[model samples]
Target: MVPAPGPRTGARPRRRAGGRGRGRLADGHAAVLQERPCWGSLEDDALFALFRKTEPKVQEIAPGHDPLGDLGPRGQCRIQGLDDDRVQWQVEFAVHQLDGLRGQDDGRWPNEFLSPAMVPLGGGLNGMVSENRAWVALPPSCLGRPGEFDGPTVVDASVGNKDVELGGERGERDRTALARAVVRVANGTLRQLGCKDSLADPGKLPPVSRTTPTQMDALCGIKGLKAPDAERESLRRTRVTSGQGGPVRTCDLTHSGRPWSTSVRFMTVEDPQLAKIFSMAAMTGGPRIKGTKGYGTLTPSRAVYERTCRTGRAVFLVEQRQSDRGYTLPRELLPAYAESEAGRLGCGPVEMKMPAGS
Candidate 1:
């Protein structure tokens, strides 16, 4: 059989040796088997599918090896959170010994007397809080662990000199004086942990207020106060119940010469709680009663709601009886009503009339 012949002159071949067969057709090339577009032309979803085909299901990098390093001399490392979302991690460093001085008392000689001797160089100190606690940042490398020094080191380090200058009156460093330095260290450490400056001064920072009237105009134009739905429900529930009672009246008028006086004779259904709720309402809404600042301790047997009508001269009482022994008004009702003028303006169920003469 005759082998298939190559394409005619000026016609490109169908397959290439190395390249993937996904390329775009050149303009006006209507030749056999139209060429597919290059992968770059594919949409994002197609690219993801291509990726999944070429990658392994579970390739491991540095598998079976420990990821963390040894903790330094202090056996401590800074702990930081992974993100603003509150994940925590611990980091560790290598441990090594300090290089100089054999004995603890080696540094005892006065600066003016003995020549300096070599001091042991040691690994830096590591400071840490509890395992899960958050850390602000790491201390400087020099301060982390002191290095060994040779013979009467001239003690001319500017770092040490600065520390001494800023030291407190007690001849030792005062923490308050080091506030700026501490902040610098903390900022550096936080940067290493991959946080933006915004996270550093979060809630404590003051809000940026509108400076121009135009900037605030949008907010100011929003109309109407938001009322809680619960408050509306409570107001609706405070309407006086039918067949329960009539409006209360009093005989002792301030027009006459008597201290404000009104009496409520509670029915068997009325209890201490109901009496208290109404008594509180009267005190808050009505004129101040005699001998009390609007507030009155209820003698449940005597009255439910009592208030001074004309200054301290006359008292009017709204008496009520609970529908059942267990049905006294809730204690919270008074405060609930007082919270809104709409609430306090309306009265609750009442169940009695003031007896004639009393």
Candidate 2:
């Protein structure tokens, strides 16, 4: 049977002399319990117990795979369920501390997880954030499929200033199932921690529609940015998602079923220190985009720019590789893309200037 983490609201599981438990040992020799205290006032131990009741079949699936371990901020713990010695499903959980409200914006969680490849999980991403904390659920990278993204697998819920990220992986089921499961755990954790902002009912969450890149404005969530007919020549499918109708947007494009080749992401960095870093990079790291409020730097791999929007400082990134045969390169479309998005975001006009010939 899968070992329980501990009794709800009670003592944490203890580690034996040479076994897995709350503290770590020195190479199986020393018994000095080196345990990192769980930061923040939230009761994470109680929150984990909810996992036992939240998903009962886990023990039945992989009785040998214990899901108990303490790795918050210092490490992570994973639970796996297998069928005939093969991993059928798995869940990984970890917590990270936030620096004095750093990355405390509404888009913090989404922006951290949003990527060019996070588009195929069907329903996109579901999440909620408040003044003190945040939480999000989305697809996790498949274990068997290696390098492919599919199952909506992870939930990142913050308690106080620390982030509690939980990821789920499934072999045969669809993304929605995992999404629901993770969301349940996330919501349960929030309630256990007495967090005020709980996510909406997971059952009501809708699946994302796989559509062609026909509507530019809708695809990227930026108004007036029309899709270029030529750009669609290589497009096979695209997933566009907005988390809880927030300003953060993600658009990933791919030709094959998995491993999206091209991606467009926009996020507003609310933390002043974070924004200042981007601003400094815009001024010193590379040549300034002529018509925008930020700077532009292009390598063979990715093209990115940052601008000052009415909301604060915003970042726009277009990552693509020529081998992917996905979308046009940095020089071909990034300038126009940045301009359109900047305008929609209520930022000043920007013009990108490529360095001297070639």
- Please report, in order, the local distance difference test score of every candidate based on alpha carbons: 0.21, 0.39
Candidate 2 residue-wise lDDT, 76-146, digit = tens: 23434333335543444332222222222213333434432222222333443221122353221211221
Local lDDT at 79 for model 2:
39
Error of 1 at 345 (Å): 8.3
Off by over 4 Å in 1: 1-292, 299-320, 324-327, 330-358
lDDT of 2: 0.39
Mind giving the per-residue lDDT tens digits that candidate 1 earns over 1-358?
0011222343532221113453323542212212211211212232222221121111011101122322111111111212222332212211122212332111221110111110111122121111111112233232333222211111110012111222134222222212222233334333433435311221111111111221111111212322133322211111111121111111111111211111111111121111222433334432332332233222222232332222111122323222222222222122222122112223222222222221
Tell me the alpha-carbon RMSD of every candidate.
Answer: 36.2, 13.5
Predicted structure 1: clash tally:
22
Off by over 4 Å in 2: 1-75, 82-86, 97-112, 116-206, 213-233, 242-244, 260-292, 324-328, 351-354
Scored by Cα lDDT, where does model 1 land? Answer: 0.21
Worst 10 residues of 1 by lDDT: 112-121
| Worst 10-residue lDDT window, candidate 2 | 55-64
